[model samples]
Target: MYAAVEETVQARLILSPHRSVRLRTVLSYLPEDPFAVSMAFPAEFSLDEAEDERSAEDIVWVFARQLLSSGLELPAGLGDVHVRPTVGRRTMVELRAPEGTALLRFDTTDLRRFLWRSRLLVPEGEEHLHLDADRALAQLLG
Candidate 1:
């Protein structure tokens, strides 16, 4: 059987030091996709205010699970997505796209709790056992 973990967390879109927007973010992980985690934002939310339209569907960013874990303790990631710890029990996640960059601030406790719950489903170092390499290879080959 496969299991998935989803946690809803409150976050702040850091528009500026004084200006910010509150956002409801969903963090999710599935044992089937063992090595990755996903962050989904509301459809109404626009990463780029200057864009012509707000996406009708939720925006989800998928990245390595280990990157998030490492980020909890120190800065991690290189391009498109980056995660790092911040002052006052907060974590900063930077998402970069052609439209613009979105700087999100989340509570460290919330992220930690989410990660812990995901680990219960697919523990660290055991992801390889759950992965379907043949299926992945087939998808890539296609």
Candidate 2:
């Protein structure tokens, strides 16, 4: 078992052709706007990437995949929040509550591909992977 400690959420979204992900902590909260990069974090976290010969993007993706695979915690308390995906990989997590206020933001590029490939940890295993990392992130975060 692992003791829970204060941690930050550090995530990186790779560009096209090789969309990948990375983060130091398990994501907890997501802002309403999917495109805006103002997501909330625990204010304490870290990031990791190996010395593989792959490009920086590839490294980030690999790290992200490892983290995502190690994690399966989903989101909760999202009843009226809205999720919006822009033209680019940018996504927004929105919430319009009538009682309280809490906000945080994070952005992801090509989230579906990232989630499918990363969670599966199969870089070149399949072309039509069937997983929704993007939706999971948005719903969980939002």
Tell me the spans in candidate 1 whose CA falls farther than 4 Å from its real position. 48-55
lDDT of 1 by residue, 52-106 (tens): 5544667899999999999989999999999999999999999999888999999
Question: What value does the lDDT take at residue 73 in candidate 1?
Answer: 91
List TM-score per model, in order.
0.92, 0.27
The 10-residue segment with the lowest total lDDT in model 1: 47-56
Q: For each candidate, what is the lDDT?
A: 0.91, 0.33
Error of 1 at 123 (Å): 1.0
Tell me the tens digit of each residue's lDDT in model 2 across 1-142.
2111222444443334456455342432112221111223222221232323333332110122222322222332235443444444444333444543222233443334344433333343332353457866889999
Q: What total of clashing residue pairs does each candidate reach?
A: 0, 20
User: Highest TM-score: which candidate?
Assistant: 1
- Worst-scoring 10-residue span by lDDT in model 2: 29-38
